[model samples]
Target: MNALLFIVCVIIWGSTWIGITFQVGHVEPVVAVAWRFSIAVVCIGLWMLATRRSFRMPAHMHVKALSVGLILYTLDYSFLYAAQQYIVSALLAVLSSSVIYFTVLFRRVFLNKPLRREVLVGATLGLLGIVLIFSPEFTQMTAQQGLVLGLLFALVSFVSAAIGNILSENMLDEGVPVMQMNFYAMGYGLFFMYGYGFMSGASFTYPDHLEFTLALLYLALFGSVLAFGAYMKLLQRIGSDKSTYVVLVYPIVALGLSTLFEGYQWTLAAVFGVILVLIGNAIAMGKLNRQLKIS
Candidate 1:
């Protein structure tokens, strides 16, 4: 079950990079993200209603949803969409795996969980693999204006996402229902996105292109709802630290799609990077069959 969830998440999220790229030109990135969550919230809300899931939650849980909405949905995605304008989505996807380290650090500091050596080492190698995978893009950095800023925004997005990951894990540990949490969190996320759009004076134009339309629907339905559902379940099954190994694997998928869409070419370094990522995944999650059964 855990393995299935991990695969589902990786495949969907990896494809979302290409979908986000299609969104780059049609609408303001902030508004595009806002629209994506708007659609996602409605779907989740309907699904919750159909299943008879109660929407009731304590005040603190609402607060948690708000925090997640602001940091994860609003900031993380807002910056991510913006950064795609300045860099290819594959590079941004690769950069995102850094969240593993941040998640681990926050878990250690806030939750008082001791850092496990093997996970850390595995994550380090995974990060290294992603860098090597995108090393060719880095070489062009000298000629790319705003590349540094784009990279900075991507970093901010990853950190915000990592913080949100920790918060969600805590919420799950406290017995918060996943579907209910996502519905409320996405609602608040949509609210924050609208707030940000108004404050920034970003135009709220709807996209009419076929690619953008398809991308928006896919992002909302599969990327936002299904992918997150599977991922959160993985968090429930395996701990957050290990579930994040999916991050390492999905960027490779992003790059694979990039080959066709973004003109990304595979190189010797990239091949070696893939090999390292596989090794790291093995090291990090090698005991998953045992751990899942034990848990």
Candidate 2:
């Protein structure tokens, strides 16, 4: 179940970048985000009803869910979108790798998990791999005044995501079912997204193209609903500190997809990056250590 959920999350989220590309040009980013979660909330609510699952929770759980919504869904994405406005895509991708380390940091601080040496080593290799994968883009990045601000926003996004991961894990430890928590968290997320859209006077620019609408549905169903569901469950099965390594695999999948669809030419550096990422994953999963002992 753990491996299955992890694979589901990595593949779903990896494919989401394609869906995200289709989401643009017709809607404001935040509004699109709002729409995604709104659709997810409706679908999840229906699923809960159809499955006869209880939706009731304590008042404090509602608060916790709302907090997760604000930090994870709202602030995390808000910062990422804003950062992209000022920075290059390659830089943004590289900076986002900080999520793994931030997850480690939060787990130690909040959950009091001992900082394992392998986790840091694996995270470092994963980050280096991502940097290698985007070496060309990184080389071309210009040092503008907004670069610092963009980097800051990206870090904020990473931290927000880390907080969200830890919060979900903590909730699961408290006996909240993954689907139930996700249902409420997504509900609150939709609520905040709508609130932000209204307060910011974001215009509702609905997609007229069939492809765009299809992509939006895919995101809401696969990305928001299924992917998040699998991811949070993975978090519960394996502590957030380790499960957060999914970020490391995200870019490798993106690059492979790009090769097929975007005509991305794989350089030697990129191949090496793929190797490093795989090595990092092995380290993270403790496969290398186990194999050594078995031999």
Candidate 3:
């Protein structure tokens, strides 16, 4: 069940990068994100109603949802959509994979979990792989203003997402139902996006392009709702530390799509990096340790 969830999440999220790229030109990124969550919230709300899931949440859980919405939906995705304007989707995807490290680090700091050696090693290798995959883009960094800022924004987005994941894990620990939590969180996220848009003077124009509309629907339905549902479930099954191994595979699928549709070329460095990332995920998951019977 966990494996199936992981694969579904990886595949869905991988495709989201392309959807996100398509989302770029038609509307303000913030508003687009806001709309995405708005649609997602409606879907989740309907699903909850159909299944008779109560919308009642404790005050603290409501607070948790607010914070998670601000960071994860509003800030993280706001940065991500902005970053895509400055970089290729594949590069952004590669950089965003750093979330694995942040998730583990926050898990230790906030939850008082001990840092495992395998996780550390795996994070290092996986990060190195991401860098190698985008090493070619880095070489031209000096020439491209967007590249540098895009990288920075991607990092910020990663940190925001990691924080959100930790908070969600905490909420789950408190026995909040996943769909209910997400519905509320996404509602708050939409609110924050609108607030940010109002404050920043970003136009809340609705996109008319069929491509943009379809992409937005896809992002809302699959990326936000379905992918998150699978991922949160995985987090429940495996814990946040291991659940984040999804990041290890996101780049492979994102880069593959980028190469096909976005004209990304694979270099030897990127090939080597992918190999290292796979090895790192294996180690981080303790598959290698179990095989060796290491303590």
Worst 10 residues of 1 by lDDT: 286-295
Model 3's alpha-carbon lDDT is: 0.85
Ranking by lDDT: 3, 1, 2
Per-residue lDDT value at 256 in model 3: 85
**Candidate 2: segments with Cα more than 4 A from true spot:** 143-146, 290-295
TM-score of each model, paired residue for residue: 0.92, 0.93, 0.91
Return the lDDT, model 1, position 67.
91
TM-score, candidate number 1:
0.92
Per-residue C-alpha lDDT of model 1 across residues 221-294, encoded as one tens digit per residue: 99999999899888877778888888899888887877887688799999999998887886777554344332
Q: Write the per-residue lDDT of candidate 3 for residues 29-148, one digit (tens) a residue.
A: 899999899999999999998999899999989999999999988889999888888886446656666787888899999977777778778778888888888788767655556678
lDDT of 1 at 231: 91
Q: In model 3, what is the error at residue 233, expressed in angstroms?
A: 1.0
